[model samples]
Target: MKKLTSRIDKEKLLLAVAAPLLALVAALVVTALVILATGKNPFPAFNDMLSYGSASDSQVYILNKATTYYLAGIAVAIGFRMNLFNIGVDGQYRLAAFLAAVVGGALSLPGIVQIPVIILVAMLVGAVWSAIAGILKVTRGVSEVISTIMLNAIATAIIAYLLQPERLGQLDEAGTLVSTKPLPESSWFFTLDMGPAGQLWGFIVVAVVVGVAYWFTLGRTRFGFDLRAVGQSESAAAASGANVKKMIVTSMIISGAVAGLVGMPTLLNDSHQFDNSFPLGLGFTGIAIALLGRNHPVGVALAALLWGYLERTTGHFEVIGYDKEILGVIQGVIVLCVVIAYELVRRYGLKRQQQRVGAELAAQAAKTDTEVTA
Candidate 1:
């Protein structure tokens, strides 16, 4: 009985990891069925996607995409850890990209000087933008979710206004499109130079550095302890002399600063300009990635890689006469499945914990009775 109980307990703990894996499998099965219904060989289609997704050149593309997603995911995860919802990652990234582009374009210095300056300015811009929502939440009792959403809209408008020729010079002489002047070639990131498989190695380096810094900040720092305490119980944290408000604001700032890093891949690797079309909808997708990864740095990186692989391969489906919209469906299904699985596993764990505690209490009671009788 003891052995069986131990096995069951192990299985319950494994469920946290198993659930997402099962969700991915389930999603693929459903997708295959849908493809078969449409008179297509789902196996060949999937195999083709896999082949392309794993190719050397494709790996580089996916890695670049993963870098952006990972940074954005971390930003959302940081807020999630603090029980704060930062819905303004989109705005934060956009403003950061704009500032970075502006700084890069304006500078005429060496690569070392210009690159760091651009990145720093962008981070500062994003932090300030996100800090607004944090301040509103702390001071006026406004929900971060609502404030962040509204701030996102405001940031969008601000970016649009800044794209004007008078503010930031337009990319084209006519100023028809909403964009900033391109950066000097010296300001761009150095590519891997690994043939067709070459990638933005600088972005990957930055991601690793940021991930390490984030881990240290959250796991080893005094502020991290206070943030965790406040997250677990604000009232208790306050009673214990933790400044809950400061922690909340600090977390938000850090979240935004991390979010700003998302633009480095795009600005330094590809466009080198701030354009309306460049930012995309990465912020929202990042939230799903964060949840799927359980908000852990390693998990988030893996999740981002998976997402990037799917996105890159999905485009190839069109070449093989399949609908690319299937990718969207798959993404949505995966996210839904993962969410359901997480909730189920979480509840199961809670129940198991309760059961274990109850059993321990009963055993203690029996032992006491035995002692008293003897």
Candidate 2:
């Protein structure tokens, strides 16, 4: 029995990791089969993706991508923990990015001051925007899901209207795309001198700091406990002296502020300008990362890294005459697999616990019978 329990424990741990591993493997296998069916050599394509993904430049690109995803993932996960479906992250991030770009473009301060100012503005804008949803939910009993979704549409329209050269016009004179003027070089994110890799040191530092802060806030803070209590049962929490309304609003604000940071990697490090085509889909992608990571900060970080790696590698697919859309298929498959695996593992764990309790009860009964007979 001891050996059985030990084996089960090890198996559970293995399953926890293996689920994601298996998902990746399955995605690759399916991709390869698709390539073969198309009469392309999967070996060469896979090799190219692998090589490019590991290259110095690709590593830096992955790091930048990971940073964005990490911030967005944490934002989504925060809402998840509070039982709030904040689909407005896209809108929140867009508004924040626009505000940050505008602030950076208008500012003439030193790098230290200018950059921080821009980031702060972004966070404030995102927080305020998200708070609207929370307020509606608290005061009017509106479902966050409905409110956030509507807010996303409104945000998209606002960005579209603002991107025009006439209204909030900041783009270059030459007709190119919907964009803002480039921020001053002084306000750009600090890059690590990694030769051709082009690492963004600021992103790495910020990601680590945010991760640690988030962990502590959720695990140790009184506010965090109140938020979790509200999430578990709003009535019970309210009865226990917790302010459910305040918790809801607070959770949304924090989630949006975290999401607002997502644009930093692009605005401060990569582009320094707001563009409509500058990967606005990251907010939605963060949802997948949050789900895949099970809303855990460390897990979310790992999930973001995996996503970044896959995204960077997917560019190589274009070289092999394959559409980069293959990455989408892979992502979908992996997310599905991870969700299924998590459910299975959870059920298995519950079953094990039940069995352990049953065994203990049976042993107690047997001992009692023996004692009575003697």
Best by lDDT: 1
TM-score to native of every candidate shown? 0.91, 0.91
Model 2: how far residue 181 lies from native, Å: 3.8
* lDDT of candidate 1 over 1-374, digit per residue (tens): 47647866787769867888888888999889888888888998888887898889888888888999999999999999898888899889988898789878878999888999999998999899999999998999999999989988988888888888788856576646667778899888977776868754568889988888878888999887788888889999999999999989999999999888888889998888888678677889889899888888898998899999999999878888998888988888888888887887788878877887788779889999999999
- Off-target runs (Cα >4 Å) in candidate 1 are 1-13, 36-39, 173-178, 364-374
Clash count for candidate 2 is: 0
Sliding window of 10 residues with minimal summed lDDT for model 1 = 169-178
> Candidate 2: lDDT of 320?
68
Count of backbone clashes, every candidate in sequence: 0, 0
RMSD of each: 2.7, 2.6
Predicted structure 1, TM vs. truth: 0.91
